[model samples]
Target: MEHRVVYLDCYDGITAPLLLGALFDIGLDLNALKKAMAALSLPAHTITSQKQDAPVSGRSARLALDAPEKAVPWRLADTPALLPPGTLKELVRQPVLSMVKHIAQTTSKLQKLPIEDVSLPDITTLLWLIALTLGLDMLNVDENYVSPLPMATGSRQGPHGWEPLLLPEALEMLIRVEAVWYSTPDNKQVSLEGAAFLSELASFEPVNFSVTQVGYGCVPGKSASDGGQSLRLCLGNLSPSSRRAPQPAPSPVQTTLEQAESETDWVTVLETNIDNMSGELLGGLLDHLLELGALDVSYTPMQMKKNRPATLIRVIAPPELGEQLAMSLLRETTTLGVRFQHMQRLKARREPRTIQTSFGPMLVKVKYLGEQLISASPEYEECARVARERNIPLADVYEVARSEVQTLIIGSRKKT
Candidate 1:
């Protein structure tokens, strides 16, 4: 089955108002947001989000502040209080708290100040944080992917006059997550509140996923020339792939228990996101990666930038094959770059055992934790063939095979 994913293109950078606008633009319910945010007990306020195309493309999200920055600015530690206790839905509570902690810690580490000194975002941003968190849950969002930071250039009019392009807190978040950022004379700075929350929720996505729709987040008060002024959200589904037939040539790296366990220290992960390839093309690419000696190759559906459906291809292999596999990705896919990471890996000792079953003979992979039994799984191909020949339910073959394997293993252990 395929699942939904949203990709936020933060080329222009984000602020609380900007995030609100984007959410509103991307089909976030304006009225629902107002009702949800009203719980803050903030001074009288009304939010207006219109799907306007000018000033910025897509739709515009406007937080009309009926009150000034309010006396006694709320600090990061006080964020929990800003939204009344028990006001948040249980599903979003932990994630929202996690966002708050990420923001505070990011601010503290970068500014050389205590977390308590880090101030809470203004009313608009605060409200948007809650809305976005709740929205992610409501959308049943399985994952979020964020682009690299775009360096802020020059200065912007701030409450205290001209200030650095991107807010300090936002910059801290960019640095902490090690987000790859680019700066040009034409870059736009991100907002303090926008940066922290967006950074926290993002997980890496590989290339070549599928996108189904798009929503735009238009920043108010900024034009295209301002740089990084708008946000584009690409929505898509990631399909779970069917299992592959066994490969015989080089066999497989994990053919034996020892090789699988010993690979712990040498495994490297290679990934890339691709949007321009078709399903037929991907099959060829998968075979190519495996021929390069990949222990496993998998594809996940993902939304790529610029309203494109893409695939995130992941390859697991020993370190020795890293260079070759990476070369294969670049040579075969539309991706401009590839990402590599070393991973700690372990596998239970498993071996094929021939077991008697009502259908006839069956092959099962018996696994162990040291000397103790773990599980015995009937091979898919074997079970599938049994189902086909006898015209029985596939489930029946699986259940009967599992039961016999268990009985046989237990009897042998007792005799020992």
Candidate 2:
């Protein structure tokens, strides 16, 4: 089936209203969206799309929501209480509900808060309704539909300060929606979570396509330059491929089992020697590096020349991040210089799986060699969190997560 490609150019920052307005402008049916909201038992809110003029993007869309009755704030746990009994099951189908659950899970992890403590803004619930109405879960497309850059506006406070403006659940929902494409130029400043979401969509290669339709969504806020705030949603279609004459197949290359088993990729290893830095400073720097997406960061005590004891900071990261990591080492530590080397690494295919545990849901990293499962371990950070929240030993949380994942895997095998 030919699927329409949708690109969200958030020239301004994105909000739930902006997103829904853009989708609406791009041909989403209002009645369907309203119907889904009714099924969810949410308070009545009116969504209207209107054309407005902007200095930068010219004609754009404006979306307004009216829900005066729902003035009280609600958390994720409050969702069930807000809706009628069995309303979710009766109104939302499995696919849409699954998408909603996934978004909630991602938001919970991102915020480092218990699922019950995490607040669901009104805009977020509305976005879910739009996703359900548009059948976002059923779209046929690869992850490449989203852009690489994080979503941001050119404001003076910088991207880090703008984090509060984003709704984590809404952001996750947008990324996983199959057919819809989210894009921005390379020069834009995207939020950290927005950039992370975009990275998941980076596996898709660019295709040549033409714009078939365009829509604009505008926010009521003012831009830094006193211009109007808006975003463009472009609908594109790939041109038909021309028939070509068939050619002879190329011969396959033969390789030994040892060679196949020894498949390797290059990674950058950054090292810096610090003798004068305090342990507290070094520890803080290490945490910061890990937060910035370092694959691994470790330190080893070593004796330097003249009997001075020093710490060797080692960072393992993708080759693309070598330069940035090196700069960080210089800026954040007392290191005058940073040395890096490209080393070959052999790794098994690894994927993350989530399992429900007594404490909560924990993410498990599972590794596979061909079709055979090799190693499965719960993510240490998540397990540690569960332990802290549940007032249990960390080891206990790990065991429960591991056992749950194993049971799930076994059950799936039996079904197959």
Candidate 3:
């Protein structure tokens, strides 16, 4: 099944209520959302949605929380404790849980605090609600894709020179999601937080995606100057051939045609020399960079000055992420300088295909180059996982996948 792509346009800025409001506007059943909230034992809240013309022509949702007349600020550590037994396990699936954990760990590291120390009740609650609404399936999101612009950092003035306070929780949410941050015209302090939140969520600028629907949410007493005081949530579908699209049946003729028209693009290569960092740290760094969207990362042994043994770290990434990734390298590694170059790479048309094996279903990467089958390999990670679970040799699983792919390819060729 194709994963759904949802975009949050915080043109006005993001708040907990605004996030919920947007989800509600986007066809999330109000009863379902309320049930999820109740499962979490959250405070009573009412949702109101209506069509509005200020920001754009769309429906908007608003959430009103019923709080005590005098409520004390809650500690971030205690937020998760409020959830009912098995609530998180039931509501948040593995994929969404992975993302949530990433956010918590990253925030904890960035803030120089324990994971439990990072807390914002409203943000945490809203995230759970959003997760429950969206379910646990992984979105077809690129690992290395970063927003072209950064989120707004400073406060902006209003008609009366009133500066809006940016919400730390909002900013943290954007960073955790790895969304781009940017400043929009007609900026106001009131919208800064939401703007930052939305900017990051809605940051897929160059990709060709179509917004199938739009949802809006509003926060009372937090209106932007343009009267579009609501958060716009856009649910988009990636263009055909998106990685997130379902794998089509293997077709050698179609694969040949695509390979014939395959295009080459310039890819950036970044290298840095390091001697001080430990091998364990380098390994971890490689994993981090790959997760951040590096096309490839490697380390080569070389001799530095004074006959000292060192490792030369190399990273290949798309041109769009060259600078950002380069900056990350400097920040994450002990290297002070980096050398980079761009070179053309010819990529074969490829897609993933699943084959039934004695052990289980295994995925194989089928590659084609201009009407000719170039390569086919079992996805190592999948094979490894199946091997461990089945208590069998990894080579047996690999051979099964390879034999099946070979049979398919040969049969397709004979048919053509």
Candidate with best TM-score: 1
lDDT of 3 at 99: 37
Ranking by TM-score, best first? Answer: 1, 3, 2
Report the lDDT tens digits of candidate 2 across residue range 108-225. Answer: 8787877766664444453444343343322322112433324432334434564423445445544553323344432233332233333332223334455777766665435534
Per-residue lDDT over 1-416 for candidate 1, one digit per residue giving the tens place of the 0 to 100 score? 45567777776666666666666665677777677777766666777877666555777666656766563565768766655547776446545665677777876876789888887546555555677787676667656777776786788788879878777777776665677677866656577667767666665344334777777777555575753367777877754331122346654554555433432344679888888889999999999889879999999999865778888999998876876787777668866456665555666667898888888889999887556566788899999999999999999988998888888778767875
Residue pairs in clash, model 2: 61-216, 61-218, 150-190, 151-190
For 179-260, candidate 3 gives per-residue lDDT tens digits of: 5556655443323233333332334444435677776766444346534466666667653345332458859976665648
lDDT of 1 at 222: 53
- lDDT, residue 212, candidate 2: 71
Model 3 worst lDDT run, 10 consecutive residues: 136-145
Question: Residue 300 error for model 3, in Å?
Answer: 14
Each prediction's TM-score versus the true structure: 0.57, 0.41, 0.46
Residue-level error in angstroms, candidate 2, position 349: 30
RMSD of each: 17.3, 19.5, 13.5
Highest lDDT model number: 1
lDDT of all predictions? 0.70, 0.56, 0.59
